[model samples]
Target: MDPGGEVSVSEAPSQVPPTAMGGEEEEPGEQEEEEPTAPKKSRLEEESLRAPMDAAEHYVELRAENLKDQEPEEPEDENLKDQEPEEPEDENLKDQEPEEPEDENLKDQESEEPEDENLKDQEPEEPEDQNLKDQEPEEPEDQNLKDQEPEEPEGPEDGGPQREALDFSHTPQMLTGSWAEFSSLPENYLKGCKWAPDGSCLLTSSADNVLRVYDLPSELYAPCWQLLPEMSPVLRMAEGDTIYDYCWYPHMSSLDPNTCFLASTSRDNPVHVWDAFDGKVRGSFRPYNHLDELTAAHSLCFSPDGSHLYCGFDKMVRVFHTERPGRDCEERPTIVKKRGVTGIVSCVSFSSSRALYACGSYSCGVALYSCQDGAPVAVLPTRHQGGLTHLVFSPDGTYLYTGARKDPEILCWDLRAPDKVLFSLQRNVGTNQRIYYDLDPSGRYLLSGDTSGLVSVWDTTHCASYRSSEELQPPHLTFQAHWDCTNGLSVHPFLPLLASSSGQRQFSWPSDSEDSGSDTDLGAPQERRQENCVCVWWSGPPGASAPGPEDTEDREPAEQEVPVCV
Candidate 1:
């Protein structure tokens, strides 16, 4: 295919070039007033030019000014993305009832033989570089856990001693494009996805009371199912025959294998815990919801140990503490009745073993607050022009992945050091109503399933390392991975599998046998290139896990959750 004509889904746009509106003759005074603070015709032009800050300030200033409307691709961009929408066999596969799907087919969809993608390895594989080009470029995405030294970055324009508390940065990595087309779901939908820890298989909610897993090693020939259109909370709750927003627990740490619980929140407005093996509602809880009419647990999460459950509904994020073998906390969440929360709490997550709880969109932009105080610590500004759909913190808790409604793009933010955009993606359609998302335990990659019936992936390793340019160089593939917008996406908690839920089924991306890439980066360009998906394949030093064990120091008993403003 001709590179120029390829339609790629972009992630984060680097800079917006100055738009010269057709020359409109304006009066001198009018033109002068319209411009921002300009250079005073200072007699010190020569002296100022010779000032020490000249070179440093000029570079930073130019980058900053160009940063706003960037929309630029990375210097190390990948092949033109935006694939022709592949017609999935899922629509036809859906004719079968949830009561029975060939177990062998399900296994095949979830099976992968590493990155060779050669189903029949009987034949020798292609050369390494050729193989990489044969597959979607791969990159690593991660967050900065508090334990790691913060990455110092340029601050906001108003940032200075005046705004001491804001931990913003300047050297923000620009994300060029996302898997937007993959996530084009019908308006007003909810869904979820999971990536394998080994980057192999992906599992997702089928909205049919069954699970759909995808295997990526078989090439375009590989796939998964339960690919679904994002459905409503109630519809999802009923799809699985019992619950909604169901999920597979991470494989890291000490946990039972069979007890691999997939928790769900049903329309009965109860927290239903299920055994992943047979879809049995092992245990259920109401938590803070008393009235069946008012009770509805839309988002449900389990602590790493499976000892506790965190569910959000109405406008409050509540907890259900499980103690003895068969029982959970009789009391409701303390924060729900008290503390402060605005709008409806859309999603919630725990950082460093539940030491901190981050909730977002309920109050606009993502807010990071102490799990103990409920008082906000930081509110990472939303990267999109639209309202935030979902945000997930990297496993180590150093970075954050986010998605929004309107456009298909996933955004990355670093919290340990300077809060800056690491990258963005719109390839995966995580949700249509502009909500719903999931993250892998390693925190290196992000997937979103959108309305378009495709799941998108964003590898963020080169987000900060590459520059924007039009030149075609292999090492500089940035922000250029895309596929159909999926309804939901799932990255295996224990494997490297990524599954994106679509109209009726799913697809997968297993890690390639090839390493990310060698060191050497490119230079920033004076002019940026325009492409549908500008992605990069990077294999920088494998980012280490945020220091310390997952902090699961459980909280003490509470009387009841207090809602400051639900």
Candidate 2:
């Protein structure tokens, strides 16, 4: 296609076989220009995101501060000369540079003949006195798998707007608890939660596909009972089945207050409405559950009046009518195919109005999908391109909050002014991606249970911006919440309680409003299960100074590895 027909064929003398060669071979010099060069602007891109001021001052200060902190680099050149394979100055010998000695010479010396045996034995002893600078005896920093590779942009070839350097992650408090078997309910992990209208009972669902009933701690607060749901699913979860979310309608049932009706959606793709009063399956449906055949339901929320239910599924947000009884496809799912990751929606939450809702996804930033037609209001993305894991709209619908693994804090945005961040709270628990968290009904409290088994509580309304260590006050709570990582978390609709779920872990935090005796009740269980103990409201010395990574300046010169063959 170009000026020279042969030019495209061979810039290098064709390595064509003898029978195929028709032209002369090109010299080695020509190969230089033909080699592919990786993009050279990567360094510039990295530098542009750093603090723009005189890095000179920072570098000098950092260097001085680390003078005694860093270990000295190993001297590889001295060892290379001594261990290189030497040859006699014989005329018949070919001109060749010496090779560096093997770092594995200790084992090689034992097998080698006695001639170089002395040299072999000495190599083994040298390591004891000389420290290898390549490895440091410290924990490696955690890195998210998603960040290992940056996907090629679908837009401009050069890529879209450049991203800012990633911010830091919060260190989590390690919790210790498990959501195992309830007295008579599911034998699997906890999956969903809801509070009774009178706060007399707590209804929850687990992996076994059956709802478990726990008596509320009390009427003045939340109760702590272990009762079985009157009605539980017969055909329970299969080897691959799971329960992702569930919710209880906050209505004074015409039937009775003792029997409140609740809804449950499973990873198996079915939604079952149950009678909270007697725990009976009232109705069931599977709207948009069949989506191209991969079914997953991540979240669900009840309408303000408890008259309707909204469910999120792979690629769809279905609005189902609870007023009617029959499960007909025509009167079935109200599907909204707004945004999806591989056509699957990740998280969805309702704002104050029936028309405005916030939804987060695997592929796109969190956006407010219109209740009118389900179109995105605006894309919520950081300049650094963070992935959103959960979305919770404030009860009044004035603020929309989102959370993720890295900045384990909550980012609240005013719905009216979409661009400004209303509040940002940093969660210093184990920073993990896909972390599970929730906000209580009032939106005044935020709870995060992370991979580290730490169920940390935050005062969302207490502070607005970052306060340095000196200005920091004691947190509301930072204690051992779970033994394994927290898979999900939620709050009682009206009570001052929190529910966290992790590896086979479903723990209900009782109301803290009661007298001092409340602590004794909670601590009794933890004390009985001491070995596998879960500490509460844990206190300790100031956190260990953050452990940083290795010092790359200690690397040995590359010249030592590649000998001067000349």
TM-score of each: 0.43, 0.47
Per-residue error at 420 for model 2, in Å?
Answer: 4.2
Best by TM-score: 2
lDDT of 2 by residue, 33-69 (tens): 4324424423433343232234657988899778745
In model 2, the runs with Cα more than 4 Å from the true position are 1-187, 218-240, 252-259, 288-298, 325-342, 382-389, 405-407, 428-435, 465-476, 486-496, 501-566
Instruction: Return the top candidate by lDDT.
Output: 2
Residue 128, model 1: lDDT of: 53
Question: What is the per-residue lDDT of model 1 for residues 1-566, given as tens digits with 9 covering 90 to 100?
Answer: 76554533231122211122233433323434542455553334334333434666798988887884483333112112222124323422442455335543554576464323444563454555566655533331122222122222121111122122211121111111122322333221124455433233334453334443333322311232111222212111233243445554543111344544556655655666555444456666655445524366666666655566666655556666644323244332324334434555566676764466666544455666665545566666565655555667776777777666664566666676425565565443333354355654444444454454333344445443543222211221222122223444443333222333323223233443456563322322111211111111111111231111122112110111111110
State each model's CA lDDT, in order: 0.42, 0.48
